[model samples]
Target: MEKFKITDLDLYYGTFKALIKVNLTIEANQITAFIGPSGCGKSTLLKSLNRMNDLIEGCRIDGNVLLDGEDIYGNIDVNLLRKRVGMVFQKPNPFPMSIYDNVAYGPRTHGIHSKIKLDEIVETSLRNAAIWDELKDRLKKSALGISGGQQQRLCIARALAVQPEVLLMDEPTSALDPISTSKIEDLISELKERYTIIIVTHNMQQAVRISDKTAFFLLGQVIEYDTTENIFSNPRQKETEDYITGRFG
Candidate 1:
């Protein structure tokens, strides 16, 4: 049930090396968290999984990032790869259009043009994001009009609309209130039953709350990776113990 296998990954932007030799295997239908301080390259590694770094001007990767045994950097359709692996950013970035349109956008791009099909996909995606009941009545309204938390959930719904197998979340709840953060945390926990989730989070408590596995990143390297319980309770590395114990990040 391995979803991703990364080995000897080294990423760079122009002259600066951003990530060092990294190796990890992400399992299927589980939540894996990348936690570290700012500029530790956790987010860079997350973006690398789906090839989001390709958009950067001088970004280069010298390593293997395999998705389901196939090299993602190999001869493959990038669009199709992206369709199967969706991402949600730190802030909720809903389209200026209606909520329904936002959810239907992915299916539409992938050639699902029928209204009936789009409607079903929209509703189902919203339900999967745990926001259908909240937004069903407001599908025609501008997505920008919703609260920040609702907007984030809508973004999640949009990611789900593509029927992706893996969902990459980059600090998904950082911009929300405590109540909103809790709601999204619950939603993410529920999502692991269907999608393999890799989240880059600065919040250690959030990782402990939802992730099945935790990978601690520092100085552009993964210091330790293990079950969340082990990483938090019985860490093998002094650095990990220092980090989890609030000694230093």
Candidate 2:
């Protein structure tokens, strides 16, 4: 099933075009990585998936973004759309609360009032994120008190707690230590069994390691998109070959 279809997508920030006629199909229950150099609109295109650009005062979009065959930008509710497509940033941003509260925040906001229900949801989400065993005894501790790797896992748990159908990650492992980065990469592989994931990563090795499909971006355009093996080993375009071979970024 197709999770998202972005067609002729163009984005602007006060007359500066950020994305130029970008098109792609993101499949359900798979990991798609967006790789490119700086200022290439990788993150810009990721944010557009859930309409995060709407937060910017003068940002505008000219395109069609379909989520499950429905036009998300046309008449869909932004708040509801966001719930279905959750986002996690480069940094581990846990609210200044207990670990349990951090994971339960989304469900509570969406009107889940029963204690047992919240407990069940939090436990399931943490386990799915592969951090439940590590933090099971520290549920009441401040989220800030945890280690960086644990904190990043906590953020992932928090996003999963919402039971989102799609998860968008922007440089999710860039701020972590080597071990933490590996853990997150492993988690991404496991996550593709349930939720569709789209990640913007500058680390070519990481993209090759975790993603099933790879999309290479250059100067706000999609240069090449195909299976990870093909994009890295047998690119159809010279630009993609040059970028991957370290000849040019």
lDDT at position 26, candidate 1: 100
Local accuracy of candidate 2 as per-residue lDDT tens digits, 1-249: 899999999999999999999999999999999998889999999999999999998899998999999998897889888899999999999999999999999999999979999999989999988899999998999999998889999999999998999999999999899999998999999999999999999899998999999999999999999999999989999999998888884
Q: Rate the local accuracy (lDDT) of all candidates.
A: 0.95, 0.93
Instruction: Give the 10-residue window scoring lowest on summed lDDT in candidate 2.
Output: 240-249
User: Which pairs, if any, clash in model 1?
Assistant: none
Off by over 4 Å in 1: none
Error of 2 at 222 (Å): 0.6
Candidate 2: deviation at residue 178, Å? 1.3
**What TM-score would you give candidate 2 relative to the actual structure?**
0.98
Q: Estimate each model's TM-score.
A: 0.99, 0.98
Q: Can you write out model 1's per-residue Cα lDDT over 1-116, one digit (the tens) per residue? A: 99999999999999899999999999999999999888989999999988999999999999999999999999999999999999999999999999999999999999999999
